[model samples]
Target: MARWEPHARQRLADAALELFAERGYEETTVLDIARRAGLAKSTFFRHFQDKRGVLFAEDAPAGPLVAAIAAAPAQAGPLDAVEYGLDALGRDVFTADRRPFTLRRRAVIEAHPDLREREALKEAGLTAAMGRAIAGRGVPGLAARVTAELGGLALKAAYERWSDPAGTEDFGDIARQTLDEIRSAVAEVRG
Candidate 1:
């Protein structure tokens, strides 16, 4: 086995994204990504299962965001907890420097139907994960499920806005704004 190199996964992900953007996701091969990363094919396999896996690797933000939600103050409501989690993730994971790479990745995923399906599945998984996490905090099952679904919607909306080139707001701000919009919509429907 090749000696494990620190930041190897990130290096491969960066290279893969760059290649995916330049040559298109379908045109880029694993070997091309490995070569760009200055690593062997085996190294690429060790980090990611395949070319698509490189785009959907374990570095997903959902896990940490769920953990943050679980750690929110006990007095916080479900949406409040979700907002806290989004803020935590935005601060810790989606830093300003990562915006360009994120936009590029989104563009690649958007251009490909298969990748879009994968992205939807990933979002569903995140919703389920968030639901489970919220339920674990003693929230009722139905309420937790609804809250999680709403949070997922807010996250998607926020991410879409954040990925826009002309958008100036950060992820956390966008997420909060989206969540508020959701709340207002729900209230209007109830009234």
Candidate 2:
């Protein structure tokens, strides 16, 4: 019988991301992903419910950003937590052993307008949740929302850098650098 273990699920994610890049999302099928992962069709079903689930797998670091933000130091300002939460994803998945594959995933999404919108929607949800979390920590809603949106913007810029094959900086480093730039810009505006 096909299993629904983490390794099997990861295999499904890898296969799905790879095939989505190579064959295009609409052109690819769950069977193709299962075959690429060296698993059975039932194995794929055992993990993800459908082809799209492969894209929105619960295990991706993107899904953890809110939790990380919520768990950061209570004294940490909203923006600081936002930066920390986003930075937490750098070496684990988005920029880890799967960096190249992650880039491919990004490229494919870039080509599909609907996918791009979906991505934006996903980010917005994360941002809204983060904003609410920050507000709960005593940050004003407006400031918390700005912090969340700024974090999302930083994520976008960092992903762009990460997806560029010619870009050599580590994703975490790039994110920190971008955060520094944002800080400087904010300080300049306030001064």
Candidate 3:
């Protein structure tokens, strides 16, 4: 049996990312990550199911996004509610200090097809959860689904821009701007 180690999860994640970047994802083994983190292999299993899980375990829950949406003003439109969720993500998850790690993680995922597929599935799950949250606010199903999809697009775009080494804007600000751009594009398409 393995006992809980302080900061074990974060240590393992950092070590895994470093290993993935250095040795390539396919070449990095779970035992290697455990050794890098100075934790027993059981500790790695305690935190994540596998090596790929190390990158994604922290985001396994959509709770923060859904909570932010639920906390939005009652009068807010579906997209506005979704924006609130994105803002929360910026404030809580994708802070400026995490940008470097995010860039490395994105690169690792992009380099591997399996990880890319998992990332896509994760995004789809997140969007589905967001749509459900919107519908809970009394939005129509179609409208909720549309808002969720648009929000997903905005999130991806904002993340890309924010991850740029030269970008200095906060994640929340970039996300709001990206959502606005998405809205404008949709309106133009409707014309």
Candidate 4:
């Protein structure tokens, strides 16, 4: 297959997952992944920087995620717009196609303290980006950050529920319940 084919990155992702599972994430090399996908090393490099790159796995959609939130109906509340962004992330970033690698990928991330630290930083970056997007929609500062934080937490909770084998609930349902909990908690604290 051509390296520049439309499905090439997906092919690479699949190969990386397989190799990560078979050899353990640390043992898997980018070359091994590319070779597994029946492509050259350049093809793997073209799709990702290295084996760890598969963990991030999102080559696109960054701009669009922020842009969608920024471009949401002006009348929408800040948290509502953030919810829209989180919903898009739920559907796109953490979907079934990517979940197959979750166990090993998360394991790799967990085992390395630095990787987990980086994950935290990434989450902060995502929140700040969402906050900026909300602020762009005319929402103010702390309010925007607060809304973004709740959105991120809602997404996190929804993902946790999604990861459960007994989790019969839908992502949207989980998000609603999680956010409602946050609302309740905040109200209780104020009271």
Candidate 5:
């Protein structure tokens, strides 16, 4: 058996996505993913808990996001902090090179009910984390929660636009634009 190698986690994820696309998520197995990645099955287990985990491995977005929010200027509003955090994500996690993989992964998740449910749970968890991060910055709890939800909505909408095959805009740019659009729509609704 080949020992674990560097980039094992990424390899496993890539392999899993390829297999899920080709064979369908329900038909793919952890072992098959391992084999396709040219890594040992143990390597897969070390990186992910199970088949479902392969797709969700990179879902942990709280650290960079929270840190960015915390690092924002002291006078920044909740939404401004969210924009800072999302910009950080764009710089660190959702760079241009990651676009192809992200698009593929999104398609795979959308095609399956189980994966879609998991994606929703991940989104909720991320939103809650963002709320806590914003609240920690001295924003009111309700306001922080609202900002986080708005940020989540912007993130989703931005991702949809950013993942388009013809889209060349940076993730941060799209996110900022989407958030602004949402903000405008909210104001109109209230007026």
Candidate 6:
């Protein structure tokens, strides 16, 4: 067992991602990840429920983003609140320092069909959470659902842009731009 050290969760995550990249996600086991992290298997279990959990842990983004949405100013409309939430998540959770890890994780996820399905489920969960938050803010059910779905779509677009190696824009800027594009597309459909 490696010495009880700080950043154990981060170490486990880093090790998991590296191992998943090196050996493929399907072949990488929790024990392999723990060994690579210089930690015990128990330590891995302490931080994550399973190998997949290593990638989709509670600290990932969903909860924090939802909380941010819930905490947005009451006066803000549903879409504005979503933008605020995305901004908060971009600034606080998905900082530039995490970009490399995010890219690597995305690569691993995209390489696997099962992981892709799980990723879709995770995004759907986020959308549902956002819808609930918007509804809690006194928005009508259908409008809240639509706004949240649009926000989710914008988030996916922004994340793709942010993850692009050639892209230079900040996440918040990309998110806002994506939202604007979504709004414009909707306007075009309505006209």
Please list the Cα RMSD from the true structure of every candidate, rounded to 1 decimal place. Answer: 2.4, 3.0, 2.1, 2.9, 1.5, 1.7
TM-score of candidate 3 to 2 decimals:
0.92
Report the lDDT tens digits of candidate 3 across residue range 1-191.
34657889888999999999998999999999999988999888988998878778766348888999999999998999989999999888888888877888989988989889989998898889999999999998798889889988888889899988789999999999999999999999986
Tens-place lDDT digits, model 5, residues 1-191: 64539888888999999999999999999999999999888888988999988778765677888899989999998999999999998998889988988888999999999889988988888889899999999988789889999988987788889998889999999989998999899899886
Alpha-carbon lDDT, every model: 0.88, 0.76, 0.88, 0.71, 0.88, 0.87
Question: Any idea what lDDT model 4 has?
Answer: 0.71
Return the candidate ranking by TM-score, descending.
5, 3, 6, 1, 2, 4
Candidate 1 lDDT by residue in tens digits, 14-94: 899999989898899999999998888998898789998876774578878988999999999999999998997789877
* C-alpha root-mean-square deviation, candidate 6: 1.7
Q: Give the per-residue lDDT digits (tens) of candidate 4, residues 124-167.
A: 77777777888788877888888888876776667676666555
The per-residue C-alpha lDDT of model 4 at residue 65 equals 62
Q: Give the TM-score of each candidate.
A: 0.88, 0.81, 0.92, 0.80, 0.93, 0.92
Task: Decide which is better by lDDT, 1 or 3.
Answer: 3
lDDT of 2 by residue, 12-104 (tens): 888888888777899999889989988998888977889877665644555567667778887897778877777777756565566766676
Model 2 residue runs over 4 Å out of place are: 1-6, 58-63, 91-95, 187-191
Distance from true location, Cα of 47 in model 3, Å = 1.4
lDDT of 1 at 68: 94
Error of 4 at 125 (Å): 0.8
